[model samples]
Target: MMYQLGKRIESIVLPVEMLQQLKPSDFPNQWEYEAWQRRNLKILEAGLLLHPLLPLDKTDTAAQQLRQIIRGALEKPLETGKNNKTMQALRSIALSLACRTFDGSVSETSHWADGFPLNLRIYQMLLEACFDVNDETSVIEEVDEVLELVKKTWVVLGMNQMLHDLCFLWILFNRYVVTGQVESDLLFAANNLLMEVEKDAKAMTDPDYSKIISSTLGTILGWAEKRLLAYHNYFHSDNTETMECVVSMAVLSAKIMVEDISHEYHRTRKEIDLARERVDNYIRSSLRVAFVQASFQYFSIMSLHRMSSTR
Candidate 1:
């Protein structure tokens, strides 16, 4: 029955129309939502088997260990703000915890050589791609080639650590760049920075150290943004609004980092800005009319509330 239900769910990718109407708060209890999540996870697991391009492992002990680590890490960041720093910390913690839990002896044996360099390289490549939109065609093709090489290299090296590192990197990049946050360069840098910061924090031994780690990293990222802006004229084209939008988004990302470290305010405003840009681009391209219509309806409702309040 579980397998059948999972298969059914896997056959359907829920439309944006359906997702827009969902409200988790409407659920009666935590158990109800958990059951939904478990079903969804099963569906995803099953779908993985059908994909020719993706690698799958049925007895993936590392994957099982990752689940336990993620549960613990998710709890830590609830009180911390939902900013970039906290998100990255949670990711790093989960990766470390997963390694420790999966193969306890191996985790101790390969502590320093696992996650850092791979995370750094991934971040660097992503950030570089954010700005390169020109006659430089086949960029994505090149990236895919490099990724294949890296995958092959990992197999040759016989290290499961690369798998965990890449999984976290993929999740973080997808969440911020491919889905939520839209400023490609900033999203790229932010994802990388989070991993880098987490690496540094792990070395600290002071009590109440997480706060110190978060604040210090937040400040450094903010400083780096300013440096990038100071040299922006050298890198950006004058007439390119898309590039301008990317730069603006990067600056806004720093504000999110600050909010996460200090808990000063929510950074939803920037997210809304990026969403607006994406929506406008979609409308211009006529690519997903249903999504555009739903967005318009949402905006109309909000605008009506504003006008009615003024009256």
Candidate 2:
């Protein structure tokens, strides 16, 4: 019965029409809006809370509710002058996971999918809930649980690239939050996942699915570039370090393309050429940004030195 329910929820992809209707006008006020989101959060929390007692179907219903809540939350804007960034992060993370589910890869989801559904399902839910309910120690405990789940389930889920990519993204988010850094380990994992997806890009029969996968990879790359720039800001005094890190990241990306995604694997010669050109352009743009930042820092330092010497 639970397996049937899991299958049913798995089949329940939220339609575009329903998504279009989940706008802010649907709610009367901020409190009620938050209440609706919290209710969805509770549904997710309850499913994980009662996972051992309930069947997988009920558990999946919780996952489905979480997915719906993410979609609804995204359509509506948050109230002004409130520190709801955590809530916003929850919506983004859950939406990424939701995207994975509906990308058609979940149809043949393996038993490995069942290994820790609750842990994976309630990640962002638990994190946002912690902001409301927990103290420092409790928040740390929740982070540990999510990280452990991420580490354990990561390799197995690579069998499904969509799942693997989003799951890796969740791991990257948590790592950044907990340690204030995106570890090289996480970046390498993401690199491998993107390469794996690209390797099969020519073989994917569904054009929509292939496009979605490519879009997701692009999003990951965007996130990475943003992180690099953010890290550089903090180390503006060390231009060498900034240049090396940013250039190394771009090079790592180019190296992955060269070594893994061969021309023969591409659907056509034109496609492979376009892919190579895109990576080259990305590297050049990244270096240009880095050079501009470095120039600004150098000029700032020189101005400060001149002022001090004049004084």
Candidate 3:
């Protein structure tokens, strides 16, 4: 009886579109709803069942571990203000999260090919199909190719929450960034991709994706100001002081470009230049200290890796 009940639970948790087809009225009894919930609970508990060798708990831990790896990767250039530290950190976090969710393991060596690549390809295909870009015959052929790829990949990887989020990010990036390209078809395709992602986002109940998307959008918007002033303000209060200093310097450079030398271009140019230069000098001094801290972090990781190998 328990086995039969469990089987019934497993059968009902289909795609939302499929679930919508069957009404509670069709179930006729409370037992059916209870069985549905039980199956969902079981599926949720299993967590990336394709990689059974890696237990869900391990996968969860791996996600947390990858965050540390990303921090290490970004810390160096960030400290020296050689790159956009906060933006680099955000990308690292996104990539780390995707790796954990898709690969079902955390290691120094992991890439989108592990699982995310295939998932993203299918997502892009689906977005294209919705627009009927090709002729009727070509559309059918393309969809078949996409479906076959999805089938083979899923057989190897199984579905996971991380793949879903990666797809969302790909769609978002394609829509907002890639769409700015000069190509008309590409821009249209990007619009279609974002619409699909927005639909998927609405379906998800998790708060993490929401938080990351909101923060990422804010970061991108701040990047558009031509000066890094907005970026500095956003990351200043966070532990990313190195990134803040870099952005402050960038903002100072931008101020210099707009003011001081361009007296005929603007009235406040000289005043802004003097103030910005002072701030820039202060940040540069602080950055030297940050570089030392970043160097220590890098060496410590290398030392730990060496010790582990010896054991």
Q: Which prediction has the highest lDDT against the true structure?
A: 2
- Candidate 3 residue lDDT tens string, 1-311: 32543533222222211223344456668567545534432332222222222333545664454345334433332121215554344334434433343355564332323332243444555444422444321224464575455544432333344444445344444443444523334323333443444455445554544444344434432443322333333345643543443344344333333332233555554544655564565456556556777799999999999999999
- Taking all chains together, the TM-score of candidate 3 against the true structure is 0.25
- Cα error of candidate 1 at position 102, Å: 10
The candidate maximizing TM-score is: 2
lDDT (0 to 1) per candidate: 0.40, 0.45, 0.41
Clashes of each: 0, 0, 1
Which of 1 and 2 is ahead in lDDT? 2
Ranking by lDDT: 2, 3, 1
* Residue-wise C-alpha lDDT for candidate 1, range 1-311, written one tens digit per residue: 32543533212222111222333555698667445544443332232222211233557564455445345543431222334554345334433432342323423221211233333333344434523356221134475465454553342123333233434343334444344344454345445655544444334443333443444344444443443434333234653553454344344444334443344555576555643554355334443444566799999999999999999
For each candidate in turn, the TM-score is 0.25, 0.36, 0.25
Clashing pairs in 3: 260-269
lDDT comparing candidate 2 with the true structure: 0.45
Candidate 2: give its CA RMSD in angstroms.
Answer: 14.3
Model 2: weakest 10-residue lDDT segment is: 12-21
Query: For model 3, what is the alpha-carbon lDDT of residue 200?
Result: 52
Q: At residue 196, what lDDT does model 2 achieve?
A: 53
